[model samples]
Target: MRYPANHVLGAQRNGVNHVSMNMGTVPPGGPVRGTNYPVYPDKLLDWYDSAGAGPMGMTSVRVMFTWEAVQAAANGPVPAPGANYANYWTDLVGVVTRCLARGMVVVLAPWQYNPASKNTDITYQGQPIQPAMFADFWAKLATAVNAATGNDQRVAFDLINEPHTDEESSLPGDIGISLDGWFTCAQAAITAIRSAGNANTVLVPGMTWTSAKAFTTNGSAAKWAALTDPLRNLGVTVHCYSGIDSPGSASPTVLPDACSALVQWARAAGAKVHVGEIAIDAGDNGFPPFGGTLALAQAQWANWQQFCLANDDVVIGWNWWGNSAAGWWNAGDSKHPQGHHWGLSLDDGATRTVYADLIAGSVRTPRLVLHDNLADPGTGENTTTSVAWESPDIWVRQWADGGVVAEPVQGGRSCTVYVRVTNRGTATWPATGTDVVTLHWAKASAGLSWPQPWGGADPALGGRIAADVPIPAPVAPGASTVLAIPWASPPNPLHYPDQDGHFCLLAAVTKAGQPWYDGFTGTNLNTNILRMSHVASRNIHVVPPGQNRFGSLVVENPHREPWRVALAFEPLDPWQQPLPSVQGRLVLRPPEHVLHRLRGMDNLTEAGPGRVALVEPGRGLQGLVLEPGERLAVPLEWEGEAAPALRAVAYDTETGPGTPTGGQTFVLGEVEGWTVEERAALV
Candidate 1:
């Protein structure tokens, strides 16, 4: 299996569509602490215990354990009983233990290393707090937790929370920590854990100036690479906010540059990565419609979560900023007269719409789907053989563009076996217009190549086929048909580890049409022929009574590749002839209804193979793309009084010399006593 058993969370069948927010470090060690705001009666911990426990402790809590708490009591005697953690650490054990007894997972975060303030007495030996402090704190915390949760391995830890170079909001003129400082902190912390005989995994943040945070790659990378131990599987935690970027838009799906770049980089590293924090500063204050920050936040969160889902090999989770009430930005409780609030929740116990959305979307871990061996009874030579399938409740049907696509058009993705046979003996194995040479296989995914098995053909259904099939049909002298049909691929069952699997692929078919048109051809959608229920008929007319001056383009050579057609019109001179504008530029006649253009904008912009455009009939008329064996009737007419004559051309680009040419054209003559509505019908 290429993927590990736990990789279901990373199993991006299509991609991830939802993301989480870092709602306040869910009070790691304490009895119960809300955001920066005071917890309701400080007994909020009791409230959580009452709430349904999710997969983790007290609902699978992934809490933060601060270094500031672990390293306090500086130069003093180290104390006899030590810093009193009864309120913070001791109470936390109760939360974890109680939740564990109820079957919940507790994810721990060993917090940051805020180096000493540069100036002031905050300096340690003329330098900011050294790396030793991080290691010291981590070791102490690990020991405390190990002793605390004797039987529960669910008490795993994440290394730090947003480590960075600049220590903002520092005392005025205070020298802050550097990126190199972050490296030392990460390394020392890791070493300390292993030295203490523990194997808890810690997530590490990638080095660089990502988003509004300080600390660029220069120093962070230098310090990180120098680490002595191997830190291969540790996940990368990143922060992303959705404010400012989604301005003026509702349901904004934003993904900013910093977060996007990091996602890409982690992709290459093949390491686990996730957005640790994505916040919206506005708490539904209803600011200006085009609020730049708010817009950016929403868009980034939406796009980032999707990007993460697409790269599940490395990315499997995300957390938007703090929950509860205190917003992430205004933690100081400062007035927002100058700066805006960055928290997603309000102090009045009201929560932002995005708050609940993120938590519902947060990742606890991966879920998997496994099944095997679903095929047909026997194999034959060059004949249509339909296969059977049984799928995990959450199997996903994926496509070529990495989006949801149908089978048949999706090529090799629809079926695993290719049926090929030759008639060298001059004998027809199967008659024409019949399904022959059907290949059978099951569709499923496991770790890497060994994904859990999904759609396996059911043997009970006559050779494991969806519908009963007749005996081996014969093909004529020269005839063929492909047995491509619609098969179901569902997402992981609810509360299942593998909800990521979806649908994929959509496109043209390679098999040729048979003389006998059966339901499979255009009647039913089981096969790959995109047979639309109805097509737009040509509508053209001229001004006069009975004289028909308008014309239609007789579509020959039906389209094989994708197709899109937009009507074009040119202005009429006083002489009443269809001519390009004075500048010879053709006029674009926008369609009344929204047209679903096929994906190939690259060709629309530049000229190349498979490029499509409007074709011209005579003179300056343009051309368009129209594949052979397909039909599309085009309507054309001229506008004028006096029963004048003017030629209207219809064409597709690239179908000719990458220009418009060789198409049906028309000239509208005059009409007498025709109502304007009648004129509309004539033209």
Candidate 2:
């Protein structure tokens, strides 16, 4: 099927904006799907039957073979024609014949990079091969393969893997070949192959590890394009790996700009485009930096497939770097022995991962998360004890200015609630009104119960501050959008003198067919917030410095049985710590003032001054109990100082408290004495 040049590949649903990918005229046949074969040909049938024949539905295979397998020596005294030569050549031919019989396109790639030799020259048995010798190897290999497969169009020859020069090497001590020298060998190989009367497709790769970005920018495009191909079936191949430029990044965001540039180069040069090697490490199983989540890694894989599908006109196909055999999965075809595992399956190919399903055309559902902190992965469960209430995802701003500032919710004044929703899934969430965010408010409490404490399902109960606020735009995969809901005249604590002026805010996102919970019954609030990404709460209060703020909160036992509870105070990090002057730079609070204390808890035995201080940061009060269906109103009196301060008051049911079930953060605003420049100098 052919698409028009201006055809739109993205569509919006229910007023949400979806990013459009401009598609040019699509090639006659859709792009072929494929994976790389192992260095040895023993597991060819096993891989072809599992991934290629089954749900993965791969239509091509890039067979990896070493130059030493075909030739015994570098220059002279090479093996005779059609000689097996250590049984490697015979095994490789059998592998190619089996692939062709299964109606699969076979791409032959030579694992020819020499690390010990200077200039990354093509080598045989750890010795650099001359340009003429390199050409002779391809000529003989092409002739033999053509004779075996009868010059089948389904067979293609990739010149070499990741040709690079000394200037292009990102590593030390290993000098690479000159670009001109590498091109001379490539041109010679092409000429020799055509002169041998083998008319199969020829695939040429660029320098700097054959990276797509380097192909266009590193002079590989013009040189490779200039090489003569009598059959006019030359294809340009490039490799793309996530975080290829930024080393050690677990889940770097992948974009289509490089792929688009590659397609443009191929179209302009009149060469077919193919991704010879491409794969991403699935960092889902407790991998460092990804935090054992599939959201980020899967999103990257989806982006890669989308790029290939959107540009099928110029891009002929892409071959994944591996199958799941243990030795080949991470070995990287003898080039880098310690390469990472980029396979789509695990457990010796018994377990098919998310990438396998994605290759079979499965679309992952949208996973929406409202992060509790910067370090919170969407799946982290109640792991943060003191900072649960200080979420970066939810904030309160002035209604008129829409300025995001650290301030309390002023009673009887207009304010806007800003909630950031991130989509971790591959599929975009439609802007349809069904995808809604609701904001609720309740009196600040240690243990908050749903319906009873949060004003039951009825709007008449007056718990909901904002209901059914639709996200203005569609959130694409790996994208975040902030929704603003204007709250006019929020509930005033002054009018209801019996209630404390402090309130807790809860924000939840609900969409049809997504996992959601209406209440936290069996589990604690923190655990629920951690497990469910769609919900988050804020119980932070901003108080002016140099003044005493009085408030009270209820400490209740939400469980059916009596429970012992412990409370403590902890200092916030420098970034989240409030400044003395909102305009001034932040400086670390003095160690003495780090314990921002709250007095007037007369019921607890350890309520006096200095006794109630946090015992060196995370340690707090212990050995207090509340019976089932009991609630205690604890009064708090805090005298604010002139210095900038921010602290969290956390309560937990465990003895040696870890991962607090509920908490409240207090932020102090600017004082009268400090100047902005003085604070800056101190910092």
Candidate 3:
């Protein structure tokens, strides 16, 4: 059905309300009764100002108007014009006006209900009113509210309140309306509302007290499916409360799968739905007021909140039942015997209940965290080896910003950066959406500003470029996944001479191409940025030789482009013999059968134990090329004197014979292989 055109919280509107009494008051310290204390005019305005529009921050209020409060005589027919049947309707109109003034939507739910004195005989003009009369009442009421509020779109109407097959036992149990009859009344009311020139939305409820179960089980679907609102503004109002009848039932209905399925069905039907009332039971639901724990209440509340958020597309919002000290808020307090401890705030009026902050905090925002180290989800630890099986002695720092600088950039080359990410917020990460990890070319150490290095650089990168790797899995709170981000260094490095031939590579987890909402603010970005230069790193470590004196040579490439370095050694002992000659192989392999190559590399390999040779990666039979962030290790052994001293050379293939990195010398200790004395000591 056609609903109000301008409402927030995605058409359904999140809201709460005062009880089902248009005008009345229960004693401040009174006994527990069904009737809501009639709200005085001043108190009505106070409630709207304090709870409705103030701390509670709800978007709408359902004003419960009774037939008795409108008609002068219970047995009288329609009152004549200018007759003294009802007062100016000042209290009712005033509440609606104030709510609208505060930008709160209003629903007029007039029931043939009058329980102030516990009387349930619903009659007018000395005769029992028929089911059709309920529709007539809504027509007149909608007309009155339309004129009173200038036909505002924020106002809506409900034909009847909680109509069922049998009258509640606590009341008079005089008027029993079946589900079919209720549907007829609803349709009649919608027609009458339109006839009165009031175009406000209509809230149609199902049998069984208008609950999700009612809509799903008790023939509600049949009735709803048959009824049609010509205006197309009809909506379903469902009430949800855990364990309402049984005070100590073992199993309480919390987040029922039926409720979720119902919303999906409503969405398919293009209908709006509102959770008109929801609360946790004191005894059956294991909540307070019946010696239960607050944890139970929190769980119940959280489940409902998550359900609403998850289905926000079709479900409008919800409203807690009552907000007064003399109502549901009572929790057996002597000062307010009628309270139920379900109030979002305390009865003292100003004191906020434990739920005040919780209600506000229920609204969620996205939070993303980019880990500094290569997180191993399998082991829950940072890997000492390079990602993609590249290096080990690279010494990349974990849990610290600016991990070890990666290989430097060659003028123009494609690079792959691996970073682990986690969602640390309350919301779930959508598998594929506007949220993604982006690469940027940042300035030296100042990572704040991201100026486009060139035109067509950023906007060109779109649609799951990084998800190709095994890192696109959706993550929940406290869960992590990896991202293999790619970036191609500027092809013409000479064009930016002022850039000092060095810059930083930054990877950001962004939402809609911007810093995510509710994420770390101000310079504390959830991203991975590492400073890199056009240089390579090499190291030689001496080991206690087993078969003979031996040492290892390690080379680390820190640039986006691939590199090859030739290795040679200076003997520590003049009589030491050379070790075996070993051939080196390329590091990163291209995708099988893929014609394109990423980060092209040069050629170099060890000629002999102490010699150097040259070859091209992907071209020669035996040659070594280091991919960006790749590390290579080579071991050498020799029969030498008591102690052997040696110097290793690791020169870039492009640097001819010159030692770009200072060749360092390392001394190796004597080989102490399994000897008789050592074996005996071990034993």
- Which lDDT values do the candidates have, in the order given? 0.34, 0.56, 0.46
Model 1 lDDT per residue over 442-498, tens place: 212100000001123332111221322221335332222223333332222232222
User: Which 10-residue span in candidate 1 carries the lowest summed lDDT?
Assistant: 445-454
Give the per-residue lDDT digits (tens) of candidate 2, residues 1-683.
Answer: 11111111011100000000101111122111122233333343444433433434345677766565456455433233332343445556777787667545677887654545432334455454468987887888888888777877677788877777656665555445667877888889898888878877788888887888668888888898778877565778788763433443354355365566777777555456777776554443322243323565567666665555444445666776555344434322222334453455543334455545434442223445676665555532435434556566677776646454545667768888878788754456554425678777766667665544555453322377777677765778777887877877577767653455667778877633222354234446665665555678877666655544434545667778887777664444355543333222212111222223233332222335433322233344555677896656554444223333344454555635655667666555552221111112111
Name the Cα RMSD for model 3: 21.4
lDDT of 2: 0.56
C-alpha positional error of residue 420 in candidate 1 after TM-score superposition, expressed in Å: 26
Q: Can you write out model 3's per-residue Cα lDDT over 1-683, one digit (the tens) per residue? A: 22212433224356565553533322223211234433333444344444433444456777765555554433233321232222325556766888788767787775454343343233332234565676677777777778888988778776666656554335443454666667776778788888877778787877766766558678776677777766566778877654333333223335444377677667666566777776554332224345334555566566666566445545776666645434433532223433454555444344555545445544332234443222222211123212111111121221233333333334445555445556544445555423455544322211122223211253421112232233364677566565545544443335432222333334444423332121122221111111110001122233333434333344445456886655445443322222233233222222222112222323534444333333432232212466765544333344333434444544456654442322333334342221111111111
Could you arrange the candidates by TM-score from highest to lowest? 3, 2, 1
Q: Give the lDDT of residue 646 in candidate 2.
A: 41
For all predicted structures, in order, the TM-scores are 0.43, 0.44, 0.48
Indicate the residue-level lDDT of 589 in model 3.
24
Candidates' RMSD to native: 27.2, 23.7, 21.4
Candidate 2 shows a clash count of 5
RMSD of 2: 23.7
